[model samples]
Target chain A: MPKKHRLKRVFGAEERQHQTELLYNLTYAQSRRIGAVTVKITVEIADFKVTKDSDSVITTLNLGSCVGIALYDPNRKIAGLAHIMLPDSTNALDNSNPAKFADSALALMLQEMTKLGANKAALQAKIAGGAQMFFSPAGPASRIGQRNADTTSRLLRLYGIPILGQDVGLNYARTVELYSKDGSVVIKTAGRADKAI
Target chain B: MELFTLSDVHYEIMREIGNIGCGHAVSALSKMLNKKVGMKVPQVKLLEFGNVAGFVGGPENTIISIFIGISGEINGMILFLTEQPSARVLVNMVFGTPKNTELSFSEMELSAIQEIGNIMCSSYLSSFASLISKSISQSVPDMSIDMAGAILSVPAIEFGKIAEHVLFIESVFSTETDNVSGYFVLVPDLPSFKKIMSALGVD
Candidate 1:
């Protein structure tokens, strides 16, 4: 195992608002992002992108599957989220529509953010989702969640962008929040409260 | 007159209709995923329509059942499954890698099943809509990683009658990298059975 693959953890609720570090528990709203113009991106079998200049983008990647939420806040206030499933759309798309894949989803999200005053060069990214929610020996397509995470990271690199932070490749589903106001995010998983980063 | 015979054109038509309806579902999924999904028409069996659970032994045969239900003018469940090893393969294909193996039993073990179920159910229902020519909506899928028997028992099978015609369709989806196989079965009442047979040019 490489040093980079080691799990990374962050301590939460040490400072800031009490509301910032919500205990990760199921009884709560699961995961949330508090900010203006919150664009909620939900991924089913399909991927979608939402951009907002006011609020952050809140997306849920629950257990039993893999989901990738790509949030870009180039202005540090304007944010966008792309809830993506499959890693590649090559097999998932009809050839006429390329934006359906993870790589395409990120491109589209960035394009949207750019339209909303986000600088492509200044764009910083946070990626969450891509859990090993299931073990299928069949191959990568069966573990769409992992594919979501891997493909997302790959696409980000292809565009010559740096990933500042990522919480991915776990065995649990996660809910992600992108706060546009402060350019922070909170990830909540089962049995734990929300932790903002 | 033979009450129950192959010559009973209605049964034949019902089988054909089941194949057509399920084929649409396969076609829809194939188009969306850009992969070919194969299907098999269900062999008609006679059992208490309502006692489907008893016949199938509910949770016993089930490894994990992931499904979503649609409640409106019509109600139906979309489901998917695989034996343990098969599930592993299915998961890897979906996630685009090999299994982590370290935390295979964790909650993450259910993600692939749920995701696949969601896709299948949505496509199946959409296909059904085309066949019936009726508008139908679906609730978000409810996925459960439970014993096959337990999940099967959740639905009461005793609402209808015994020995009604049932249709089963099996589909196999093969991609350059992997393959997925699934089945679709329809249990229609007698009158509906007759209508289906006529639709299939059987009766």
Candidate 2:
């Protein structure tokens, strides 16, 4: 088991309780954040952020068929994110940006996460997005979302990273916020309750 | 993929195509609403696939969208978008739903709006098809109320897979009164874009 998931068990009850209290306190402030520093990964940008501070949150929006991945290293108290759009970059003729493909984005994000005191071997990932919005193009666009999800899963597995949770494949659009403190992924879909995956 | 470029003439042709197509659409809307609607000139441009949502409003703004997949001589997507309040007014006009309330639309209201969207898209397609002299048609309309980013991503991904850039036209639907307002977005595939440009003698 990853040491990050077992952090609460290893710590004493009082210390764990205190940490949970602090997190709970932050949660309320997170809702009505008057002055919080938020980094947003906009469409098509494969940006990664690593933070040791518990106060910062990383967010990505409009995840229709695109996938936003959150990887956390609990032992190092650091987290990273990548919003990848396409399943394969190898077939791309000119889109050379590493963040545009699952394979390349995962590779880049892992490198950056390790740079921030995260252990490559101890990383756990949570994913969201990859929905078939419409049954168009017969099979191409309709199936691309599933292919993106599969490609993402295949690459993550290839690196030996364990997936902690996922909320994917639906017609609704989603916006994702990854909390740095506990690596919780908050997914918001319109007219639907928020999910923490 | 070779970089797709549009010249000044090609750009103007696209704008005209947008104007003619959406003019028919808004006329259909005006007749439906029994209100005199006004519009701003269509804005046409080539955009990066990632930036398509920004063209609508933003990613997170909650809005109602109607999507139609166009395929005939040219292939692309046509989207009709409006804020919830605007949609409420439209629904009220169509289905006699109560106004100034927070109540969601009933199934009848949803289908009424869908039918309205179907008429508007058909008019838009017919106008453009006549102008280009191409046999253009549309798929069934898909309606949803969600984030703009999610809705726009359909065409963005379609265009992104083949090329990093896509061409879209943005047209505003509005009036002197605040009762009705919305946006009509057109995204044409690369081959169709080329075909139109070639038809207009813009090599």
Candidate 3:
């Protein structure tokens, strides 16, 4: 059986259609051909991806209170991006996905990068998102954006990974892209100029 | 009890709750806009963290959202979301501007939108509270114009700390113009879910 037929059989018609739409938005494969090969990977909420492909561009979209951390080893041309929702995993009721928390996600991404021939000493980070999004009185549920940024910074410092650039602590959403080739991070927001950090 | 393990009966009850809540909200909106409003049947679903963004188009789709915190008998959040065009239409209706007038959410307009959301939420909560014989209050409404996924993440992260899945009571409301439609989502936490079920005399 063809691959498409097998996927349809497993996922059914509706799921297959949804997957196709996701693929179209994620890859833009036909329209975004840079040179002979260009790979695009989308990191959804509470997910992480690490790649050493020089032609790859990894992206995470609509980061509200959540933070997107991009770590790149310029020496090895390896890049890793993690979209984490919360500050810590210790208090999570379901801690199955390590990528959902700042503390564990950074550690996991670093480990993955090192496994793919990236040097820990040469890893640098670029971070974005962590917007407050909405206003609420001071409480445990408030300032989640600040907490996520603080936790991510603290963990990176402890890991000896310097944050080279960042765009955080605002009142809007952000879309982030990390390029593996040159270790550049771009931040995009609605009705605003794209910033390269 | 786990949210995903809820039975069909529980979902049916949830559907009724959504129906009543949205019915009240629609009337409130209709009164505010002085236009005829209609609502689709409410949908109650237990959704994974990742799929919640799909409800309002997609993760990257830009939208106008209002957030209100629920307290008192239960603790949770309510989100009101509408596309840019729909938001423009609603704002225009409020200001009696031409239907095609552009809206950049000026201070006056923002406050108007916030008030609209506040009234709609209060009506929905009032109906729900009365139905369950509970007293619930809502926080001041906060508004944001951003990507749907970003707006949704606020509630997703809050709920993620307590459960793997979110139980959402989703209702879509539209006006006679048909170009104006909005989504209202109610997300109750695990303990609150239990409280609600028991209050409704359901196990």
Candidate 4:
């Protein structure tokens, strides 16, 4: 498909090889036939994925104090998912990866989604994770989960992207999946029922 | 100083800290369980934030973690973690429950695990404190059963604020019949790290 070709053209040789390896890793990536072939793309920590393929499902796992944001353009069926680790990029030890911070991750995701022919005005967002896995009596660092969720929500508002759904800020970890076909978000946590939002 | 800039001597000192600290902890665990507890030599490493989760078992692996924050003389975070099955085994050993019995982590079981974490961490910290002659205090232990990556993110985020590289001391402790290997992770802040090195007369 043209979308697949575009993906190959967009990623470098090494990144393409990494994607190929991910595809072949059946334990992490699951494929299904839903009228058309569907493939899952895993967005690891500090990573993001944007695609116009309707049969693509972008997922990020084990979001504890981190946050996952999913953006979808209804008309064009373009989707983006970012697994953001920190609230801000300022004073970060490593700022090379734009997807690692809430502020920059949204900016990068929006740029990539627009490049994939998605209408910026039609983009809607769903967010998950930002859970407080541990309680600490220290300073702000103990509440980093709440900070990450707040920062991501603020950035989304700045981008004029309406947040359609969210499941954030609990004492549990989450795994999130964003479906491009229907712009739906599913949240999974251990010992809990999977939630679709 | 940057973690990468640390020389071999610094690493060796850190490793010794791990060795002494974990040795004390394993013995405390042995006393509690009333059985011989075996341990591997502690390892000290400087790792990227992303790679820290892989040590416990890939990022997504399910784990039970106990988190304790250290303050006063040496500021840092300490974590004791094990896979779900290993957690069950450790808890059962404490309760004298049959090894094959399943655990749903009832309130009593959860408290037992927390107490074990408290004892082990305090023993480890006490040894380090006495070694440096610095007074340190630890926060109450908090427990979570979740994905390793998620649990590890707490320390990773804290360390990320000061450096791209995270320095950690890890020790694995096991028991007989069931190899209930538990990992002890220590992440000290930059200033505290410096204090430790200076206290040990390293630099």
Candidate 5:
């Protein structure tokens, strides 16, 4: 039922036989529905991706305790995506990677988008991820998911970017894709309905 | 004994620590399952947080995991992970194959596996703490059937702020029939490794 559990199912012998076909179909469905050609650029943890190609889709996956922020400029048809791990860099010992923290990650995304001819004044943000995957009692990680989502919001506000939609701080892993063609973000989680934010 | 750049001797020290900790945990697991278990030498490495899941499978790979967080003089998380087949084998051994569904694990079956994880994590931390003469305790074990990437990212996000690279050790435990094989991943916070080295009085 859950996407994670579905992954486990594919490991079984009975399902293993058809797993490849199913996965292929699923991936094929993500990009092509008939004649539409879509190119995917994935953003990993602490990494950011920006695209100006109208048919480009930037995606980030497996956001458990991490946050994925997507920025789009409708006028310029440019999208930037960043998958950040930590909530803040204020007390962090190392702040070398601008895309590693929620605060600085927003800055990096904005800069990259601007470099790609996106107007800072016309940017809209959408975010997903930051789910506390497991329950922990002795805590340094209890509410990190919420904290990360919250921090991403504060930083986006500071940049004067209005977040159009968000799906965050739940108990499921979320994969988000930002399509530059329409400046729309599609959120996918296993066992739940897909959402367009 | 730098955080990311540990000398071979330091690696040896960390490996020994892993061996000691895993030894006790597997022994406890053996007692619970009433079977003999063997463990591989823990694989120790300073790895990028993003690639940790790629070691087991991909970020999208589904895994059944039991997680426990450690706190006190040191901090970290211990993960007990296995594929669906291994989980089914382990659960079948204890619960007699979940009469209704052969494909999925029930809540009760999941709880049993969580108990195993709780025991293993407790033994591992207690054994290591006593060995180093330091005080440490663990939180309640939490169970999840999720993506390996999603499961492993919790610790990375927790520790990534302090260190870009994580010091992790993974050991595989296998039984005679090979039904109960499990992967145990221990991730200690960067600063805690230094404490461990100093407490052990090893360079």
Candidate 6:
């Protein structure tokens, strides 16, 4: 049995209880402890937005050959995440928002984050996901995960957003969670411990 | 317009054809999934695209629609899914899970389904190609999960008549302890429709 599934089976019951408690705490604290925390984050195709009033985790789960961007502003403690499925907008049927693709998503995300009190210069990022889940022996273009990761890295460099951390090009899907309350980000991959930043 | 009619012999031939087509599809799925998938040759019937939803029964009628084109020949929609459980089972089987797990689509499941859809659609087309002795290709299949009525409610185009021709087949499969069902929907172009109908004596 794979480590993740085995762990899940062994700790599934206990984890369920903990998850329930975590959800409860997050829900209750959103109002009581996290003052003015609205948890208001929009699930945009490519870009996401967050504000200081948001105290809830913003995330997208199980990204396959898709790039997920998590941007945090320590000054304002606001974070945003988006799971981009394709590399470019040209392949998509709806291209109204080019940002829905990897290249454009990062550009739009940085642009929006700056508008929401995020410093363009001090904007830190931790990206995870862009896994080659399919059985593709062919390199790069055929591998959407590579394309997603490559596109994200290229765009970030072009725009000059310093990448603080990265975990990309794996064979498993990952779930991303952003803690708006403290500007913390968590990435959970198959058979691996949750990494936080 | 004189509606086409099928003779008893033609019906039997077409049913066999449907079964063969479904079998080829299951074979492709088995290869792609790299697991044992037992699927019975579907039972084919002619019905209005609207009424077709009723035959696929469940508490909440949901259907997944995909569009496939035979390059420049036929452009048709394929819809399936008897219920949510069936969809889950499909996702599980495609992932090669031996023990039945409560299937929830993660990112892997989405891409897996896209590839499976491609294989199944190709299998179905190949089977039809053999019977008709002609070539057929399909576009990338689109996946949508919605209430049957909502999926089929495309205003005035309900009665299968408007669509050059329609073939409805039910596919049944079982995994470990769970048994599930789905449908194979095919819409043939005018020329291919006439060929199939004529071979079956539907005129």
Per-prediction tally of clashes? 63, 0, 0, 0, 0, 2
Q: What is candidate 6's CAPRI-style docking category based on DockQ?
A: incorrect
Worst 10 residues of 3 chain B by lDDT: B97-106
Q: Per-residue lDDT tens digits of candidate 1, residues B121-153?
A: 566666656665556565555454433332332
Considering the true interface contacts (CA pairs under 8 Å between chains A and B), give the fraction that model 3 also has: 0.68
Interface RMSD of 3: 1.6
Which parts of model 5 have CA positions greater than 4 angstroms off?
A1-36, B98-101
Residue A17 of model 1, lDDT score: 22
Tens-place lDDT digits, model 3, residues A159-193: 99999999999799999999999999999998899
Give the alpha carbon lDDT tens digit for every residue of A54-140 in model 4. Answer: 877888888988999999999999999998889999878668777788988888888998999999999999999888989887843
- Of 3 and 5, the candidate ahead on DockQ is 5
Against the true structure, what is model 4's DockQ?
A: 0.46
Residue lDDT tens for model 6, B5-104: 5556655665676677767877776676565667765665665322445555521254444434454333333443345576667777666674656544
Candidate with best DockQ: 5
Candidate 5 CAPRI classification by DockQ: medium
lDDT of 3 by residue, B44-109 (tens): 977777888898898888888888888887888888888878877888888888656575778888
Candidate 1 per-residue C-alpha lDDT over A27-132 given as tens digits, one digit per residue, 9 for 90 to 100 = 2233334321133444322345555645434553342234445566545566666655456656541323334357667777777777877778877777876654
Among all candidates shown, the one with the greatest lDDT:
3
DockQ winner between candidates 2 and 4: 4
lDDT of each: 0.50, 0.76, 0.85, 0.84, 0.81, 0.56
Pairs clashing within candidate 4: none
Residue A110 lDDT in candidate 6 = 70
lDDT tens digits by residue: candidate 5, A1-197: 65676655425433443463465564545434432345669998889999998777898888887899988899889989999998788888888887899988887778788998999999999989989888885567788988899989988898899999999987778888888899888988755799998
The DockQ score of candidate 3 comes to 0.50
Worst 10 residues of 5 chain A by lDDT: A9-18
Off by over 4 Å in 2: A1-46, A52-55, A137-140, B1-4, B48-51, B97-100
Positional deviation of B33 in candidate 1, in angstroms?
Answer: 40
Is model 3 an incorrect, acceptable, medium or high docking prediction? medium
Residue pairs with colliding backbones in model 5 are none
Model 2: lDDT of residue B81: 81
Residue A177, model 4: lDDT of 87
* DockQ of all candidate complexes: 0.01, 0.39, 0.50, 0.46, 0.55, 0.02
